[model samples]
Target: MAVITMIEAQKRSGRFNIYVDGHYAFPVSDSVLVDFRLYKGMEIDKELEGRLTAADDVAKAYNRALDYLSHQLRTEKEVQDKLTTLEIPEDTIEQTLKKLRDFSLVDDAHYAASYVRTMMHTGDKGPRVIRQHLRQKGVGEKVIDDALVLFTPAEQLAVGTAVAQKLAKRYQHNSTRNREQKMRQGLMTRGFGGDAIKAMLDAVDLTPDVDEQHALLAKQGEKLWHRYRALSESERQYKTKQALYRKGFKLDDISQWLADFGESVD
Candidate 1:
């Protein structure tokens, strides 16, 4: 209980200069204090309790970040995004990522593999689409390629089937030409192989008992394909030349597929 002597309380420009034990104490920034009476000596407890509370708050925030990351695998970008969302400072994020990396908790390689596995099973995606997705997730090219190696031919078939089924359902229309063009573009956009798509297209019976528009379009497309397919050897060669380009087929593959159509190859 120290007696704080207020020796000279000078009324300054906009505040009262508070002196305790003939020495300047903390500033009384509030103007309301001027209304009060101050004598020669006053008692003040200068106990700094805020220091302890501030330290505890800082520690608690860091601990929360650590606990949040312990739950699952996270990419470096994902972890950094989360850290930013949590309002953690950049320095703290660097520290947290380092700590996480040391623990083998935030490895991009492991995360990429797990992501590929999950996407393969539920997302029903091919290598190209999955690679793009992983790239957006901040995975490196080598890691993406490593993950892609796991996609076997059987997996590619499943992915192709999934995308083809979905697209075939939507692109069925009154105009068979429109439906055919839309499906070719759609399946290609979904990263399915042309051969795989051709097989799927051939296998699906577009005509069903459900709707007349679908049956009509299916008949029209079938009629056109048959007409185009049954042309004289020269006419067939001319149209086959354009089919590959229309299909977005690779130049090498296109040249190879139509080699016998109008080529000098014996």
Candidate 2:
């Protein structure tokens, strides 16, 4: 048994240093100080000392968790991982999570729903990518599924069409077929499913005007012509034909462009 010699306030707010028998024993937050009712000349037995330290540990861990949640809404797993990094004991971390859940401060369902809603209204991410993101954040599959109901087929089509249209513009210099292909690929990469991709393709108009197609072909063909310049004339024309064909130009269109190109060069 030891007797409390002093109870001194710490430089940090709401913390106190406990001294027992003229030697520093432990430090505790103000809440713990009040709960344990420690004062000078108070007798401290082994059990009481253990209780005070254990309670102080919990208090500190809880406070840390509250501060962590203050900046933004966090997943329970995120909070648990954070407390674990601080070297808080597993039981203490569990207790802190329970306290947060009890206060409705950390809820995976609410987080999942809010995330899905935000993505549906303002983001270009498809349902699959959103689900993957939520999974990585440690949200359960069931919660993600429930949340995804907010992203209906109509909403998916609307967003996918908008994204596909933007991608088509990026590939506008290519042939219409090539632009459609690139837009499909971009939609796929953005997590749109095949059905949604097909719908988006149908919705977007990739066909350039006849004059625009000729101009685009000329712009692309000239680069290939310059690229194979060191080869023999026959070899350069052959290579240019193959390159432009692979770039989604029709055979007839390639022939016309080549004839026009030959005339321009001569």
Candidate 3:
């Protein structure tokens, strides 16, 4: 580790600039080497000062990634996953993560809370659904529980209520008993819980509700209808009974709904 005192600087070529440190030091890449001695009789070698500068550059890249992340609310796993996908070095990614945590920039807990808040404020999404989303985003159960502060019974019920009302209006045509069951199935599919859905449906007036059960019933009808076409004339009646029964349709309702479609003649 030789320390040289830079004395003067002179231009040697279009790309070469020599730094005179009592003698002459030539720039080779990022490092400077002095071969001639001017102060007494001494020669030395020293590594370039690019090491610290390189550290700074890498730090900036990490900061840039964090900055892009902070421009929006990102889940912790989501950001880390992205950096991993970008092939950022593990050390650099760790350094960036530490800095972000220090600045309170990537709190998974905060993100969970924020996500729940946003969903509740916008529409009738239940806590169960929101929790699943937060968990998928790498938020822990503890953090999600903490974030569930706002989704009280009434709040949750309100969500169920809103969704049920919309469903009722949308499916007002579900005249048969199966209509209610199908709506219940749909709410369950949407991640609303049984208790919430039961409470909501119990509160809702089915009379004014639209026939949401139509699509499901119609889909079942299409399947049974297809099977009815495939059966030979003799087996037609038996197959229609078997198909509609397998489709979970009410024996009487199937007969009633499709009667207008007319039966095939032998």
Whose TM-score is greatest here?
2
Stretches off by above 4 angstroms in model 3 are: 1-54, 208-266
Off by over 4 Å in 2: 1-11, 17-24, 33-44, 262-266
Q: Name the lDDT value of residue 117 in candidate 1.
A: 86
Question: Cα deviation in Å at residue 205, candidate 1?
Answer: 4.7
By lDDT, highest first, what's the ranking?
2, 3, 1
| Candidate 2's TM-score | 0.85
lDDT of each: 0.61, 0.88, 0.65
Which candidate number maximizes lDDT? 2
Q: Candidate 3 — worst ten consecutive residues by lDDT sum?
A: 29-38
Q: Which pairs of residues collide in model 3?
A: 171-210, 171-211, 171-212, 172-209, 172-210, 172-211, 173-210, 173-211, 174-211
User: TM-score rank, highest first?
Assistant: 2, 3, 1
lDDT of 1 by residue, 1-266 (tens): 55556544347543444565667764432232432333445554555223322333334344566677678766788778877888877766776677667878778988888887887788756677788888888989999899878777677777667766777778654344455667767767766667877876665665533345434433543444466876875675556545534543344544444462335321
lDDT (10s digit) by residue, model 3, range 1-266: 44444533335321223343454554332122232322323334453434433344445546567667867988767777878887877776777777678888888988887877787778667777788888888899999999998677777777777788788767555444545777787678767787888998987787632344445565666666676787775476557656666655566655655564565322
| Candidate 2: worst-modelled 10 consecutive residues by lDDT | 257-266
TM-score, prediction 3: 0.64
